[model samples]
Target: MRRRAWLHVAVLAALVAAATPFTAGAAASAAGRSSTSASPTLMAPVTRTFTFNGTPQSYTVPAGAVVTITADGAGGATINCTYTGKGGTGGRVVTTLPATSAPTTYTLTVGGSGGKGCTPSHSGGAGGYNGGGRGGPVLVDGTGFDGGGGGGASSVAANGQLLVVAAGGGGSGGVVLGGPPTGNGGDGGPDGTAGTAGGARPNAGVGGGGGGGGSTS
Candidate 1:
């Protein structure tokens, strides 16, 4: 996501537009391993991690099992002297949501990492867990967590409920020539949270990392 010579004002908007909410499941995890059948609660919780590189994953929740999910977004590439691409947003922690119908299997999709832009371009930030895919991190739940990643969304839905969580911040451009008040740094979305702008040569570099969206880490 390097700054192009003729970048339109909407480029940033496009990136923001691509963002979406995340989601997760109800039951917790199993202690040592995944359980087939159980009571109402799991003896130990089960944990899952997604990288968003391969096919989506599938999981089944028995009558009484607890599962914990963790994921990261893909990171952006580094640029030469152009604007920095936005980092992947952070992922969220999700828990207990009523399913459409009491069934077992669940499908999960981890976010993939962002790719580098061409010359004068920079790399995108990485995605976070189940919430923001790290441009490239993760998602889930009406009420989940916010791991550290760039380009994440505010909230997500899973099993029919919304999983509220943190989103990632935007990247900055090479540097500012004149005065724009705000530097080349891209602003954070949903809440107007601002990113640090860049300075002139020698001082010019990529944008600072955006604040985490309720990150657990």
Candidate 2:
């Protein structure tokens, strides 16, 4: 089986407003009262990154500030026999969350890579964190052929509302006896569709399912 490169990244940036104190009166007295001026100050932007550990992560943003969120899905696993069928790559998604009157908390879920199957097994491996699909398994006579697992999806939410989602890739299919394996797995959802797994074999191992896509609403 051929080797594949896996890369997952997430970056967030937020801009907020600030105020600066004014010196004593800058203008001469007007009609027995001193005049003063006030201006809004722009604060520096804040950037952050999150890592995945089979659990959800959280971040807080200041009130009255706009926040941008970006997420990447994980890749699927592959199966190797005489011939190698490579897994699909992960997908990416970007969206923004509007500012609120009060400070807001957002939750992020990173995608996980699919399980692998280099040897024959009774069942396929489990899917990664998030929404990755599981690989297919086959039973022939007294032996079982296992398929690779699917990748997981990456997601972001705030106030219980889903803000953005990135789809994961599909897993590779099982191999046939004494020969090459089936076709390779499908790519992740480009726009918002789910990932697709490779072809399945009759009375043999089946391909894994792809991860589901996310929303930007």
Candidate 3:
């Protein structure tokens, strides 16, 4: 009976030791899983590029798309376009505001032409004459901002033959900022000749002096 009791006690001790290792291993596995699940995740930023009219463009925008427009070459013209998305404005010349947005169509128009010679006496300079300028009707668009007017000729009696002849003056160049059109008309050749009219405002050229009358002894 004593031997049997001792044997039972030894078996119980062996069982306890075996169970302890399983519990410890389970705890260690659970700790490893918990640490793996709690770790932080990292993501990379998104980037994209857009090309328009041979120009390369790029943006680091969020998950979305953007529209773009541009103008090239010379022509009295303005751009027109349509936009869709938040903060959109309809069909109009975009002079100010968001730099990213732009027009699709480039519409150009000729500017008014310079005035012509009415008669030697009434002839105006080449550019921006007859109400000519940036806003003139006959003027070509994008020709230039401010153009000079032609010079006037000396008055003569009807059917009267005059020997003195004068040439009209050339127009002045236009400025960057929309300034006045028309330059001073060249002075008549030598004597008593009328001077050409100057541009509207901002730009004004010196008038041509009248040509001198036929020499008198």
Q: List per-candidate RMSD values in Å.
A: 18.6, 4.8, 35.4
Candidate with maximal TM-score:
2
Sorted on TM-score, best first, the list reads 2, 1, 3
Query: Looking at candidate 1, what is the lDDT of residue 10?
Result: 9
Could you tell me the TM-score of candidate 1?
0.37
Over the stretch 56-132, how does candidate 3's per-residue lDDT look in tens digits? 12222111112221111111111011201010000111111122122222112111223332112222223321112
- CA lDDT scores, all candidates in order: 0.29, 0.61, 0.21
In candidate 2 the C-alpha lDDT for residue 67 amounts to 71
Residues 73-151, candidate 1, lDDT per residue (tens digit)? Answer: 2232222333332332333333344322333455544433222222221322333232322221112121111121333
Candidate 3 residues lying further than 4 Å off, grouped into runs, are: 1-146, 157-160, 163-170, 177-186, 191-217
Clashes of each: 91, 2, 34
Model 3 poorest 10 in a row by lDDT: 1-10
Question: Considering lDDT, which of the candidate structures 1 and 2 is the better prediction for this target?
Answer: 2
The regions of model 2 sitting more than 4 angstroms off are: 1-40, 141-144, 203-217
Q: What is the lDDT of residue 3 in candidate 2?
A: 20
Using lDDT as the yardstick, the better of models 1 and 3 is 1
TM-score of each: 0.37, 0.75, 0.19
